[model samples]
Target: MSTSTGGGVPASRFLFLGTRAGHSIADAEYEAICHYAGLPTSRMDRVRLEEGPMPQIDLDRYAGVITGGSPFNSSDPITEKSVVQQRVEADMSKILDEIVARDMPFLGACYGVGTLGTHQGAVVDRTFGEPPGTGHIELTDAGRADPLCVGLPDKFDAFLGHKEAVRELPSHAVLLATSGPCPVQMFRVKKNLYATQFHPELDSTGLIERLQEYRHAGYFHPDELDRLTREALASEVVHPQQILKNFVEVYA
Candidate 1:
């Protein structure tokens, strides 16, 4: 985690808000985010929401904010959620209120789509859920012109696996990218707040680690690990990381 000195947090540093529970998963997620964003560990501060209550954040301390995927489903019944999940959601929601209102620079991956989408009045449910695998992403006319999609191909494969999705684009959002199963692959709210249905931070090794961590978490059958690992390693997924890089370049 990055820290502040007696003066204040440096403006060039970025903060990654993580929601995964296990220490290894959380650490790996932060590492992958920094790796893909071309940010050194020293330049990226990590807040692991699963560990405890989130502290009041001073947004001015960092260049931007990024939230990682979580096992907690936004669409889950309130009664079905665990205590930690409820607290984490509340903490995320509180921060989002300020982030969205101020048009803060934020990029949410996978589960972030749900939180940000829900905050913006978009419906997020299990309707367009996709299995764990690589999916085709097509950049929209707007996507092609968007700075975040600058170096990306018109169409490419990205790793995605979620139990819920943004069923429709929020009224105030710009549809940046689309995919076959899940149409709202990426969208921008206001000028700086962004969300993605895919995991841009994931490489083959990272994906393998996540798959193992969540194997019993219901994403896929435990028996499929062998095949998933093979396919994951064989797949060429080099474009999505550009999103992370673009975000960091534009914001930092």
Candidate 2:
């Protein structure tokens, strides 16, 4: 046989997907999100994609997928993401389509909740949601039963930084986790597809830094900064980062 230009297939890779929306800067805010999620912001495994469409990365080559939050609400006005954001969302839609078709392993956090929710036909209108301060997150009965939150203690601490939440779950999505303020904090679809309403990827320190950076962007009010930041930094409930390790273990 003629010598082939390509070698045998390489081992599977893991992808950490992130999106930064308007007024969402790169340095501290972005980096901290990655850090909290157990992702290497410094490495190739971590890819910061926009809110729109995504590329077609091979499922066999990548172990799984991870998504981060963004300022673009799945319920935003048409003009929210701008041209670039719009394009990115479109691209990501293609990628997500592939993920669904192949039943690929995936985890979506924050904005992922919205995108996945909207995609799955869940009403994404921001009627029953508001950003809340740090607090203990408790899994619902269904949440405790899920593989992702299974044996994860009925109660745990997580850094929650979001503006909107699921007013209702998609038709087939199972309700998995919840906090005091946000009931639809976590859910799953078709077994492998998952989404979290909280920032499961970040720790307290990372969150504190992010709070300072994304403070005015709207996670919290400027006047509430001192109290909110201090409480969030002192909280020990943000163990959802372990969820990343757990996901890597289960999928990859």
Global lDDT of each model? Answer: 0.90, 0.69
RMSD of 2: 4.3
Candidate 2 local lDDT, residue 198: 80
On a 0 to 100 scale, what is the lDDT of residue 245 in model 1? 98
Q: What tens-digit string does per-residue lDDT give for candidate 2 at 8-33?
A: 44344466667774444544445554
**Model 1 poorest ten-residue lDDT run:** 1-10
Candidate 1 lDDT over residue span 53-168, tens digit each:
98766777888999989999998899999999999989899889988888989999998998999888899999999888899999999999998898999999999889999997
Which predicted model would earn the best TM-score? 1
